[model samples]
Target: MRRVYSIVVSAGLAPALILGACLVLAVSPTLVPAELAGLVRYGPFLLALLGGVIGWWFNRGRAVFVMALLLICYWLLVGNGAGISAEGLAFLQIATLYLVPLNLLFLGFTAERGVLNPRGIARMLILGLQIFVMLMLAGQPDVGSALYRVLETRFFASTGVLGTMPHPAMIISAIAVVLLLIRHKPLETSFAAAIIAIDAATVMGAGVIQYGYLAATGVVLAGLAQEAWRMAFVDDLTGLPGRRALGHAMAELGNQYAIAMLDVDHFKKFNDTYGHDVGDIVLKKVARELARVGGGGKAYRYGGEEFAVLFAGRTAERAQEPLDALRQRIADNKITPPEKSKPVSVTISVGVCERDEDTTDPWAVLKSADQKLYRAKQSGRNRVVI
Candidate 1:
């Protein structure tokens, strides 16, 4: 409940600040015509007080700070020319409300550093506007007019889901992004396509061009493209580089690098006893340990139960010391699997090879490493041999 309250408070700060300013300035008998003062002052004061409490309670200090500034600016500089009539006052109130919710929506969905979520947050917002249009369709004479009516409609409608808040459309887009990240079905195909179509339809049907929504679409598409690249070159289970990625790393390393091929010993037996799920956990643990062990070097999941590590700008002799230390650390570390009594104690067999400008290509170096790995496995499953 406290956390929920905090979220609400954080969410409400901006509007509260804006409304509070309008109320204090407009209601002052000295600041405006007396006939226009009552509603202008009272209505916003109530809202501002409500929003301020929520903002303060929620720890939205940044918002509060900004809101205070906006309030002060408007009151001192813009108040007289800003108008004090009922219609004018209402417009101010509604516009503030509209801006607040939109700001919150952006804050909630954006990444910490301002990278937009690449899954159509914009399209969903437009779809929401379309829904709002449909809801008020009967009351309005034309679609364009209904779409254009946001400034007029915002005050009352902003309280509803389709207004300032992220509507179902936004949520759907977010879900699609998550799906793409996790490789869940429908996200890559039908759902994504449908979202695009709906947004286009809404834009055309309502006769409104939403640039924000288009921008969001672009972001989500970029994210989807990034996801695709990861899928092509990253191991899904451990989120490490894959064989293709290893090749890329080797190319970058050129001739001045050593490669170590790592294979877990008795992995098949371990999987049979622990079941594939626990086996997966063990593999992930091993991968993490290898990553930690490799430090600045690159590690790859070279297909099932086998791994590769590439050390750039290092000779075989230079790589040997850390590689040996890594072997010992793997032997020493306690790795546990899910629902297991003791960690599925494991060690790796590694084969090392270096790329030389005179002789070895990436493939040859890899082949040599594979041969060495075979020798290590053949001799003993728990040792590293070069």
Candidate 2:
């Protein structure tokens, strides 16, 4: 059940759900109010702008670039109001179909260096160059005609559900989807869904194209929101829930819950001797052992070398065996730092307290556990005190 929950939350299900809802609304246009019908035409552009602002705020370079690129593509394809010739419009459509997925592929592999750096400015310049080239092609009948021929040429026979999509564009989109799946991070999963929606729009006709773009933009935006939430609540180094998450969890604790506070033995001294890099490795190793604790325990990083575990329905007495085992497992493990032939040992001191008449408040229980942890450290570390 826990594994299933993790998969549901981590596998980009939020974006997938958003895509499903958008598809439903797209197919049942009558479900949309007649007064708000114009939203279908303008909503994607608005969403792209909002997404760009969010990306910039989060310092997610890929989101900023992709959103800007998508906004430009949408403008040229639908919102320009330029009264472009039919041939020019066709050329722009083909160009956008190819460009969007290609850029998604490139940006997926690109590192996030924030939105205002030199690399980011270079990315923007490249996008501007592409936009300029696209406009030049659209304005020149002869050049646009030559490029359109190449873009429209079918490389293979089209059939089945996606037959309406151009062959070259379909191939590019498929490759991008496959690569994004291989990456399989939340943002990449969202990008894969967006590419699939764009391809479906090509096949489903113009009436639903706006809905497709809406789904694409909406899913990516949702993904950014999820990433931001994770950054707020999850510890980056140890992959454990952070102190903030621990506080949230404690707020809803049951009457029989036990809270265990743990601190690395001699961590400051060890860090100074072995350096911070090796110190991080030791913390991660300790976290891994703590995460495997039985008795329904949920481990969290409670700032620096301090950690916590909550056993929701268990008292300190009930939680003792597993806590002791966790302590022993961590003590048994050895970490070999770089340039060291002998492996160094790492251990922790734990203090546990359960909810009782005198300590009904969760914070009070946590403080008692922290005080016990200090006792364990003073009583010749590498032990558990309850």
Candidate 3:
């Protein structure tokens, strides 16, 4: 159950759930009331706008670009603002069918350098250029017809399972989906969901296209939210919960919980002797051992070269055995520094305290643990004190 929960949350469960709701509504139109007719028409535009604001605020270039693309495509294909000729409309439909997946692939593969950076601006300009060229071709009936013929040409057999989607578009969407799956990060998974939604919009009837785009926009928004949360509460370098998360956990501690403070011994010396890069490797190695700590303890990166473990229902004496084992394991592990022939070992010192009659507050218990940590360092590094 825990593994399942981790997988779902890690992959942006909120967005997936939203997409599933949209799919259900699409299949059973009666579930939607007549009062929601206006919402159904305009919700995608509103949501996309909101998503754009979030992307910009968070400086997530991919989200911003994707939201903009979704808004423009929704406006062009569904809103039909220009009242173009039937041939132009048909051309746009096919063009977007191809362009959406291509844009998704580009955004999925690219790094998020930020929305206002030079590279981001270049990406935006490139997308604008494509739109301009598409509009120019769409205005010329003969050119539009020629391109439409080329785009509509089938590269594979059209089976009943494939519906009426163009083979080329299907192929592009398939490739994008497969690559996104292989990447398997939260943002990449969201992109894969969006591509699938767009493809469904293409193969299904026009009535469902808006829902598909809406789901795509929703997933992007959800991904941005998840990333922002992670940035606030997770240590990027160590991949552990950060100090803010520790504070939250501490707030919920019971009366008998244990708090252990840990610090890498002589970390500054390691950084000075080898380099900051080698120091980083040492910290990562220590963090890995801490993450695997026993006794139902949760590890957190408290700050530079320091970490904390919380044993929610355990006493200080009960926590000593596991903490000592962790210290020994880290002391036994050796790290090979770059350009160095011999491997060097890293060690950590730990101090533990539990809630008691004299120190009932969690903060006080933590402070006591820190004081004990100092004593442990004074006595000798690479040891645990309780």
Global fold similarity of model 1 (TM-score): 0.51
Query: 1 or 2, which is superior by lDDT?
Result: 2
Q: Runs in model 1 with CA error above 4 Å?
A: 1-209
lDDT of 1: 0.53
- Candidate 3 residues lying further than 4 Å off, grouped into runs, are 1-10, 81-83
- In angstroms, the error of model 3 at 77 is 1.7
Q: Of the pair 1 and 2, which is ahead by TM-score? A: 2
lDDT of each: 0.53, 0.85, 0.85
Per-residue lDDT for 321 in model 3?
Answer: 96
Lowest summed lDDT window (length 10), candidate 1 = 206-215
- List TM-scores for all candidates, in order: 0.51, 0.91, 0.92
What TM-score, to 2 decimals, does candidate 3 have?
0.92
Whole-model alpha-carbon lDDT for candidate 3: 0.85
RMSD of 3: 2.7
- Superior candidate under lDDT, 1 versus 3: 3
